[model samples]
Target chain A: MFGTYLRRELLGRRRQTIIIAIGMALAIALVIIVNSVATGVRDAQAQVLRSVYGVGTDITITRPVTPPSGTDQGGQGARGPRFDFGAGAGDASGDGSRTVHSSRLTVGFGTQTMAATSLTTVQKVHGVEAASAVLSLTNTTFDGTLPSFGSRQQGGAGATPAPSGGSDAKGGSSFDVDSFTVMGMTPGGRAVGPLSATTLAKGRTLAASDEGKHVAVLDSSYAKSKSIGVGDTLSIGGTDFTVVGTVSPTGSDSATASNVYIPLDVAQKLSSQTGKVSTIYVQAESASAVDSLKASLQKALPKATVATQADLAANVSGSLGSAGQLVSNLGTWLSVIVLAAAFLIAILFTISGVTRRTREFGTLKAIGWSNRRVVGQVAGESVLQGLVGGIAGIAIGLIGVLVVNVVSPTLTGGLSSGRGVAGSMAEGARRTFGGGTGQTGRFGGAFGGASSGARSAAATQVDLSAPVTAWVIALAVALAVLGGLLAGAIGGWRASRLRPAEALRSVQ
Target chain B: MYRLKNVTKRYDAKGRTVTALNDVTLEIPDGQLVAIQGPTGGGKSTLLQMLGALDRPTSGTVELGDASLGTLADSRLTGIRGTEIGFVFQGFNLIPTLTALENVETALVPLGVSADERRDRAARALESVGLGDRGDHRPAELSGGQQQRVAIARALVKEPNVLLADEPTGNLDEDTRDEIMDLLEGLWRDRGLTLVIVTHDSAVARRAQRRLHIKAGKVKELA
Candidate 1:
């Protein structure tokens, strides 16, 4: 009997029911899209940080130096040699005179602040599993003629094809010298940060036996700049070294930052800094021992700066972190506002619909239906509508996510953190976990190529890759049903309170 | 059976009190065809509402069988109305959305009868009212005479002990009115169900076994 009444009432006025349901669906979809994107970017950031910081290495110790006045600690206007060591590689630029700015060149080895001797003392600290020091040699100019066999690189004046009608620096006619970084790492070095050995793009990483070979493993950024690849000969610091391999940091913006890497001995000998390093990368035995390791490292080398993974991620996120927080908090408030409006509209529609059926309700009441039964009938109908609306909303939300991805592919995997650690962490996680690898694939067209240019753009730009969990769907459905029931209860309460005689006598 | 003692029903019309039923006393015996005649605003409908447990008197007691309606809870009154009484309105107040058979079946819904039993009983009641063949037609599709028949079937399907009619034949043509009155007379005689009919036509009231004339909220027996 109840089913009969509900079906007749709803079926008789399907247009109105559908209209209300759609309104509720749109509200739910809005909530899903906003929150999903926020969560997706945050997750991407965490992954990128993990890759940049390395899966195993947790504590990083660097030399501390006072920045120039008016410089902020978050890698802004802090341009001295010491501050540049852990910073993302700065961009290279040239004036119209074709003259390169030497000061603006990316500094790979800024001042070798941490002494090379500090590695031994750091390893002896409690809770430390292993520690190695890597030397950064920034602004090291390379010869104009290098990697002579490959196609010219893109972006810089040296690589830019000359204008067809112009007399200036025609392609291949006037070569420009560019500054690059050459990181010198110990064989199987653990201090080189999260650039895992497994993420080797081409050929092999440096081994301890290749120390004297003058062989260099160029990071993807420098490799792309010089068109250098495996088995190519590249001249650095007036010395021609064979490019044995090319490596890119897993999911890191640093992939485009670090220029070249060579054996620590070669870098030490070339830079004339045989016993010094800029930074020391430390691996703790376990996650629980990270704080103790940092404290110990600080006590042992009081002048050196020690940081944990969280600190690195936060520093890397910088502005992105602030934006992410805004989006997250705003999403909650927006959902609340939209939900309240939806509920209000739903309640109004229900009251109107019930009021229109006063005659029918009077008839039913007069026919001996108790007030409880009448209320139950109304609530049942509303809950059914809510379930249907919730399902439609989920579909709409998923479609919204896909549409966003299609319209702006750059939003997929474009987030980067301060030191490119977010990108690095994402890349590293992609390799180690295999799940986030799909997310990085979205960066293929974003950077204009699959493996061309600087994928480091992806290091700072996060993408939406968080899977829509069951909990999100469940929450949406529950809210929809609750909204409908609330409206139904109010309408039913009013309907049930009408006296049958009065209701029957009332005008339609 | 119904007993009313000094029953008075009042209402506020604007700022002043208006009496719908004024200090009325009446007793209605079982198995009797009673007709109530009154002019407009004479409270015949109010009296019928009180007898059907659809309204309570402002003062005094109205009893049906052994239960005093004035003291009973609203729910109990609703139960009594569902099981012991049936009402037919002047406008043939059939739900327009329902077919004749469905209209009749609704009377059994609140009685907790199973679907099959309700359907069978509603079908029999419609057949008894001569609307069995018109069961599938909605009220809007039926003629005035046919709609009234469907309304009668709805009231009779519950097998109530008392049937109350408020100007049941008022909207019908003369011939249809005579047909409806004949049907009501046959049901009262054959089924022994008590009948209370309110009417303004003296010709309709002449056929009843007893007649009550109401004037300005007061009732008197006409010999």
Candidate 2:
């Protein structure tokens, strides 16, 4: 009897029922899209970690008690003078004893020189596999004096000096400004680190032959912005260099900010730092070896802080974590809006259905049907509607995700590519079918690929998973059903409470 | 068997008290058709509603069988209505969305009857009301007289002890009204069921075994 009642109600009110179903489907689709995007971002982040950073560094080393005195640190306090090499080296106390600590070492180069080089000795230490050197240089300008059409004209130069402390007369022309961090890599460093030569969007990568040839690679973003490209000549620190390549933008702090890459030997020679170095990077043979290697390095170089690849990646990725969280929070707000809309639509449909069926309920109650039976009939109809709507909504939402992937592949990590499609689809299927078993397998695949590729194409190997899409779909359906049931209950209650005689009478 | 002792029903509207039924004492015996004859606003419907367990008297003891209607919980009253009391209203009260047979079978649903039994019983009840071939027809498909017959079948399918009808033929023309009256009389006589009908029509009141005239919320025996 309940089934019969449900069938009659739905068939009789086909238009209303379809409207409710479509409302639910749209809500579910919105939820699916939001969840899929979040999942994609998370996957991409993990991929970046594995492919570029190699399980990331275990620890980071910095001046343990360096006062927060730099403008970059958001501090306004007076800073100690820029690292003074000569002033700090021979300081002695009054009792004829050296005051400087053995662990503290300072070295400097003139405006025409590079800073330091102690990395090879660090690599020779036990448990160290390879090492790379890094230098932090600011306020240095590249000379692109040759007129390029892309250069923007600054307001006619006044007698005022440039903010970079360089005089306009000294090739500080508006077109000559290029500044970024520079790091030197060894063969082993190239194999163990996240930096990749293939990420070059334009020119050839740095080679052994280019070491003494005064060649450099520019980041793609900077190259595009500055209208510079491969084969372009740039003069840095009174020396000329040819732009051999343009690297793809990492969109990360390091990549977005980096403007050039030159051979470590050439950089050293140009900077006049024959035997001094800045920082040394040591790569462990495997993830498990990180701890032992750290211990051994700590024992050998008691003064130098030993950091693993994991530690560096964490530091770099940490800077972006909060921004990602903000995006996720916005997505959550959107989901709430979608859910609230769904609930309101369900309620409206239910009320309309109940109001239209007022006479029917009155008749049923009049003919010896108990209120319980009436409520059951109504609720059963709602549940059936909800089930149909939920299933249909899920299907529609999946199609929506597919549409988004097709229309804007770059927005979804280029997943529309043949390789990306195969990988993502397989991952999506694995998640759908593998249930609990798939999590580990999927993570292993993503993590393994990331780790192996981190040193080669660090920027392109982001992890891509689709579990969030499934979860969102599930949540959307559950909410729809819940909303439906509640609407049905309210409608049924109202119907059952009506005075049968009053309901039968037509209002004047 | 039903009895109402000192049953008084009152409504409060905007600080004004109107009595629909005031201190009415009545006893309705089993296997008899009783008509409540009253003009509009004379509390006829109120009395019928109280008897049907659809309303509570403001102050009274309404005893139906061994249970006091005044003391029964809402759910318990519903159960009583489902099992022992059936109602037919003036407008026929047929669910427009359901076929005549489906509307008749609705009463049996609360009885936990099997689908087959419900269908068979509904068909039989409709046949008794001369609507056997019209089982598949909805209320809109039937005439005023036929719709009333369907309503009568729906009320009778439960085989209740008391059948209550409020202006059951009020909406019908004289011809349809007479037809509905005959159907109700036949069902009442065939089942030996107690029937309480509230009607303003003297023709309807004349068919009942006994009649009570309601005046200003008070009941008096007319015959």
Candidate 3:
């Protein structure tokens, strides 16, 4: 009887049911769209970071290159590759010009060097699964032509000799300086360093046997720029090293740790910093172990800087970060306001329907229907209306999610750490894990649930996408049902308060 | 089988007490066809309400068999109304959303009857009211006289001992009114029900075996 009566009422009073359902549907759709978009943005930021930080890097350790005070650098530190030229350094040509060539490798400007023993200390730290150290260096080559003053004087009639051993006596001088970044690693195949997030593009990767062999691997982008390939020779600090292979970052927008990669021992020797490393990447055994390990690592290496992925996330700047803030603030409030309004609409409609049916309910009570039965019937109708709305809302919300994915907007995120690890993961996450490969997901357009997010030294441009999951859909349905139940309860209470005699009397 | 002594029902309409039933004492025996006729604003409908156990009189002893109608709890009164009394309102008062059959089924719903049994009995009640073929038609789809028949069927479906009709044929034409009266008379006679009808129409009152007149909350026997 309850089912039949409820169905008939809903079908008979079609307008009320449709109106309530539509209100709920709109609220549900908005909720779905907002939540999915927020998740997508987070995923994009993570992808950017993964390109630079490598997949499993839970912590990064570095120190700043503090310059000596009271110098001409004026407290800001050294500007760049400062070169020293000695007299008679270049060869003189017939054109009265002197050509000079020199190259030097030094620690990168922003980062400091730590002892090689620190890597072992990090490895010994409790909860540390793996650790890798890198030496970041800038190789600058100075090649120039110097002017000769003596040549012009010697060409003049009755000219006297002006200089004894100056290579630029003829006085025709011009010079060119070139620079590129270089990183050195141990070839231990650890899952916590720059190589972990890269794929070998050609030839072979560096092996432990290449420790002091003067072998080098170029970043694919850097190699493309230099037009150098496998078995080619590139000069670093005046020494020609054999290029064994080339590798590229796994993430589309991520950059390699440096322009050139080489064995740590060789990089240390070439840079004249033999016992030092500029950066360390550490992986903890589990997510729960990261905080304690970070504290331990900080205690063990007092001068070194330590940062976790979560901490790095705060350094992300630009529209991606703004989107996250917007989602948490405006989007949440909008959803709440709309949902409350929808519930109010449903409740009002239900109560009014009960009012309109006063005669009918009075007649039922006169014919022996109990108050409980009448209230149940009214509530049943309301709940059914809500369930209908819930179903329609799910369909509509999914369509909204689809639209967002199809239009996949792009957001730029940059980390502000001193090392320029600029791919700060800013906005969305569902594909929050990191690995060496990625594929766009179907339901959410999320890229690589197992691979994305971390910052290198450059900001990354990433596409935002929403995720579609069973739990999210279930949550929508639950919300719809809850809204319906609330409306029904209020309406039923009104119905329950109706006295059969007064209700019937009011009809006239 | 029913008795009322000094029954007084008062209603506070806008801060002043208006007496709906004032010092009314009456006795209605089993299987009697009683008609109560009165002018507007009289105690005729209030008398019917007291008889039907729909309310508690302020100062009265109303009884049906051994049960005291005036002092029973609301739930107990409701139970008695469900099992022993039936009501037919003047407006037909059919649930507009339901068909004639579903309207009749409502009376049995409170009886805890099985679904199939309720359907079977509701259909039979409609048949007895000459509306078996019209069982599937909603109240709005039926004529004025037909809607009243559905209401009658709904009230009688549970086989109550007392049948109360309040201005049942008030909205019908003369011909339909006579037809509905004949149907009610026949059913009362066949089932030996204690039938009570409140009406203003002289024609409807004239057909009843017993007649009473109420004016200004006072009741007087009518010849």
> Of the candidates shown, which would achieve the greatest DockQ relative to the real structure?
3
Instruction: Tell the DockQ for candidate 3.
Output: 0.57
Compared with the true structure, what per-residue lDDT tens digits does model 2 show for residues B112-178? 8999999999999999999899999888999988988888888888889999988888889998888
Can you tell me the DockQ of model 1? 0.36
Ten-residue segment with the worst summed lDDT in candidate 3 chain A?
A: A426-435
Task: State the lDDT of candidate 1 residue by residue for A1-508, as single tens digits.
Answer: 6777677667766876786678788888877777677666666656555554555668877665443466433221124222121112222223211211122222231132456789999988888887777665543231121111112343456555433211132222121223445567786664436454327888988887987678987776547755777999877655789988877666544452245678887777765666777667788888897888788989999877777876655543434565466566877778788878878877888888777777667666776778888888877777767666777888998898778655633332322322322322222222222212111222211112221111223334454454576777888888899988998898888788867664235222
The CAPRI class of candidate 2 is acceptable
lDDT, each prediction: 0.68, 0.60, 0.77
Model 1 global lDDT (CA atoms, 0 to 1):
0.68
Candidate 1 lDDT, tens digit per residue, B81-133?
88888878787777676778988888898899999999899999999999879
**Model 1 chain A worst lDDT window (10 residues):** A438-447
Off by over 4 Å in 1: A32-77, A80-193, A196-198, A201-217, A220-338, A405-408, A412-468, A506-508, B12-18, B37-42, B170-175, B200-203, B214-216
Give the root-mean-square deviation of each candidate in angstroms.
9.8, 14.8, 8.1
The order by descending TM-score is: 3, 1, 2
Per-residue error (Å), model 2, residue B25: 0.9
RMSD versus native structure for model 1: 9.8
